[model samples]
Target: MARLELENLTKHYGGQATVRGVTLDIPDGEFLVLLGPSGCGKTTTLRMIAGFIEPSGGSVRLGGQDITHRPPWRRNTGMVFQSYALFPHMTVAQNVAFGLEMRKIGRAEREARALEALRMVRLDGLADRLPRQMSGGQQQRVALARALAIRPDVLLLDEPLSNLDAKLREEVRIEIRQLQQQLGLTAIMVTHDQEEALTVADRLVVMAEGEIRQIGSQQDLYERPADRFVAGFVGRSTVITGQVREPGLFESAGGLRLRCQGATAPGAASLVLRPEAIHLDPPPDEHNRLEGEVTFASYLGPVLELHLRLSAEDRITVHLPNRGGAGLIRAGDRVSIGWPQDTGIVFAGTA
Candidate 1:
C-alpha cells in the first residue's frame, strides 16, 4: 500500500483547462472516490494518476517518491477500466499472468501469483475459461484479478461498474469493496454515480468544470453541503431562490414569507431542503410551514416521492414513509407540509 499525493495537478487542451490546480492527499489504505457529472474532469484526473496522460503542470507522488513522468508499466499501479479490457484469445490464467510476464518473472512463479490473485477474487475455479464464456460480472472480476496479480502499490478504478446490470453492479461493487479492505489496498475510483461513491469511499471529492466543489464524507456532503451545487448534486434537494430579510426571516421569489434558520447575512440567498426532512400535516408548533397541492406521487417501495406545488412558481419535493392504506397520498391532493427551522440549509447567492 502507498500514500498518493497530487500537488497543483493541472491539464490543458489547446487553451482550455481540463483539470485546474487539483491538489489532494490520499493516505495509505484509503478508498477515495472522485465524483461528478460528465465532462467534469474526473476521468482526466484518474488517467493522470495512472500515468496514461501527462499533466501540463504539477506532480504526482507515491509513497513520497515523485512519479510525475513515469510510464504506466513502471508506476506500480493497477487500473481497472470501465470496459473489462480483457484479451479475447487469452484464458483467465494467462490474462492474469500477463503483467508478471511483462515484468520478466519466471513461468512457475507467475503461475503461482496468477492463481493466488484469481483466488482472491473467487475466480480460481474458472481459470481456464475464456472471457467470452463468462458473464459480464465474472469478466469484470477477471480484470480485477489481472490487476491484482502484479501486486500494485495503488489500485485505480474508472467507472468500473457502468456496464453491469443493476443487480449485478450492486453485487460486484460490494465484492470489490470487501476485497480492497481485506488487502488494505490504497484505491482511487472515478465515477458519476452518487450511490456507488457513498457505498465504497472513505472520502469523496466532487468536481465540476475542472475545479473541485467540495471534499467530505458522505454524511457531511448530505447533511451539510458547502453550497447549492453540492446540495443538489450529492443528493435530492428542494432549492428555493429567495432573499433573507433578517437572520431568521426569508421571502421567496413567489411572494411567500417563511421563517428559516441560518447565519447568512441579509441578502440574496437560497434555502436547501432535504426531501426526507419535510413532514406532512405538521403540528401547529412547527416553525416552517407551507400549503401545497400534490403535483405527483411516486411509490418506490419503502418510500413515496411527492412533488408539491405551493404556488405557480414555488414547488418542493418530499419523501414520506410508505405505510399502508391511509398514509398513501396522491396527485391533486391538498396538503400541509412543514419542517423544523433548523432543517433547511441556507447559502448565499441565488444561483
Candidate 2:
C-alpha cells in the first residue's frame, strides 16, 4: 500500500486559484474521500495526484517519494473515472489486460493476471463479454478490475458509481468497499454524495470553493461540525436563529428557549437541531421546549417527516418513526417541541 500526501498544493487557472494551499496526508491503505459540491476542485486535486494536472505550486508524494513531476503512467496510480472509460470493442479480459500489454508483460502472465482481477470483481465468468453485454454495475466492476490489473501503488476513483441505478449503486458501493478492504489497497475517491461518502469512507475531507473546509470521520462531522457551513451541508438541520441567553441557553424569536451543549456567553448564533434529536413531548421543567403547530406531515415507511410552523416565518422539520402510538398527527394540531439539553449543536453564526 502507498501513502499519498499533498503539501501546500495550489492550482491556478487564468490567474484564479482553484485549489488553494491544500495539504493532507492519506495513510497507506486508508479509504479517504474528497467530498464537496460541484466545482469545488475535488476532481482537480485528484487529477493533480494522478499527474494529469500539474500544480502551479507544491508537491505530490507517493510512498514517501516526490512524484509531482512524474507522468501519469510513471506514477503507477490507477484511476477509475466516472465514465468507466472502457474500450467499447474489447472483452472484459482484454480490457483488464490492456495496461499490462502497454507495460510489455508476456501474453501468458497478462492473461493470468487479468483473470485474477476479473475474479476479484466477480466478473471471471463474464470475461469474454463486451462492455455492451454487461449491466451498468457489472461494467463498472470490470472498470475497477481493469484499474487493479495494473497493480497500481494507489487507486483513485472519480465517482465510479454515479452512472449506476440507485439500487445498483448501493450494492456496488458495498462491493467496492469490501474489495478495497480485502486487498488493503490505498484508495481515494472523489464524490459529491454525502451519504455515499459517509457509507464508504474511512475519513472524509469536506471542501468548498476549492478550499478544505473540514476533515473528519462521518460521526465527527455530523455531531460536531466546525462552522455554520458544515453544520448545514453534511446533514439535515434546522438552523434556529437565536440570541444567546446564557452559557447553555438561547432564546429564539419564536419564543422558543433552546439549551445546547458547548455554547458560550450571550451573543448571536444559530442552533442546529437535527430532526431525530427533537422530541414532540417534554415534561415540565425540561429546559429546551418550544410551542409550534404541525403544518404538514409525510408518512415515510420508516418515519414521518413533520413540518412544524414555529412562527410566522420559521418552520422546523421533525422526523418521527412509524410505530404503535397516537399515530401521525394532522396539520392543525398544536404541539410542544423539545430536545435534550445537550442534543442540539450551537453554531456561533447564522447560515
Candidate 3:
C-alpha cells in the first residue's frame, strides 16, 4: 500500500483539453473513486497514473517516488480494465500467472502464486476453466485475480462492474470492497454509476468539464455539496430559483417562497431540496411550506417518489418512505409539502 498524489494534473490532445490542473491526494489503503459523466477525463487521469497516458502537465507520485514518466510495465501498478482483457485460449490460472511468467518466475512458483490469488478472490475452483466457460461475474473475478497476482503497489479499476447484471454488480462490488480492505490495498476506481461510487468509496472526487467539482466523504457530498454541479451530480436534487426576499427568505419568480434558515448571502440564489427530507401535510404556518398538486407518483417498493408541481417551472420530487403513505398520496392530489427551513441549503449564484 502507498500514498498516491496528483499535483496539478492536466492532459491534452493537440489543442483540445481533456483534464485540467486536477489535483488530489489518496491515502494509503483507502479506496478512492473518481465519479462523473462521460468526457469527464477520469479514465484519462487513471491512465496517467498507470503510465498509459503521459500528462501534458503536473506530476504523479506514488509514496515518495515520482512516476510521471515511467513506462506502463515498470510502474508496478495493477490495472483491471473495463474489457477484462482475458485470454480466450488460456485457463484462468495461466492468465493469472501471465505477469509472473513475464518476469521469469519458475513454473511451480508461478502456479502456486496464481492459485493463491484465485483463492483471495474466491475463484480457486475455477482456475482451470477457460474465460468463455465462466459467467460474467466469474470472468470479472478472474480479471481481478490477474491484477492482484502481481501484488502491485496500487490497484486501478475502470468500471469493473459495469457489465454485470444489477444484482451481480451489487454482489461483486461488495466482494471487491471487502477484498481491498482485507488486503489493505490502495485503490482507485472510476465509474459513472452514482450508486456504485457512493457504495464503495472512502472519498469521492466529482469531476466535470476537465476539472474537479468537489471532493469529500459520501455523506459530506450528499449533505453539503459545494456548488450547483456537485449538488445535482452526486444525487437527486431539486433546485428552486429565487432572489433574496429578506435576510433569510427567498421568493421565486413563480411566486413560490422559501424561508431558508441560514441564508445570509443575498441576490440570486438557488435552494437545494433533498427528496427524503420533505414533509407532507405539515402545519400551514411552518417555515418553507409550499402548497402544490402531485403531478406524478411511482411506487418503488421501498419508497414512493412523487413529483409535485408548485408552478409550471417550479417542481420538486419528494421521496416518501413506504410507511403507509402509498395509499395517502396520488397524482392530482392536493397536498402541502413542507420541511424544516434548515433542511434546505441556500446556494448563492443561480444559472
Clashes of each: 0, 0, 0
| Least well predicted 10-residue stretch by lDDT in candidate 1 | 321-330
Best by TM-score: 1
lDDT of 1 by residue, 1-351 (tens): 899999999999999999999999999999999999999999999999999999999999999999999998899999999999999999999999999999999999999999999999899999999999999999999999999889888999999999999999999899889999999999999999999999999999999999889999999899888888889999999998889998888888887788888745999988889999999989999998789999999988788999999987788999998776644578989999999989989888867
Which candidate, 1 or 2, would have the higher lDDT against the true structure? 1
Per-residue lDDT for 286-325 in model 2, tens only? 7777788898977877888889998875679998867856
Per-model CA lDDT versus the true structure:
0.92, 0.89, 0.90
lDDT of 3 by residue, 112-188 (tens): 99999999889999888999999999999999999999887899999999999999999989998999999999999
Instruction: Give the TM-scores of the predictions, in the order they appear.
Output: 0.98, 0.96, 0.97
Q: Positional deviation of 219 in candidate 3, in angstroms?
A: 0.8
Write down the worst ten-residue block by lDDT for model 2.
319-328
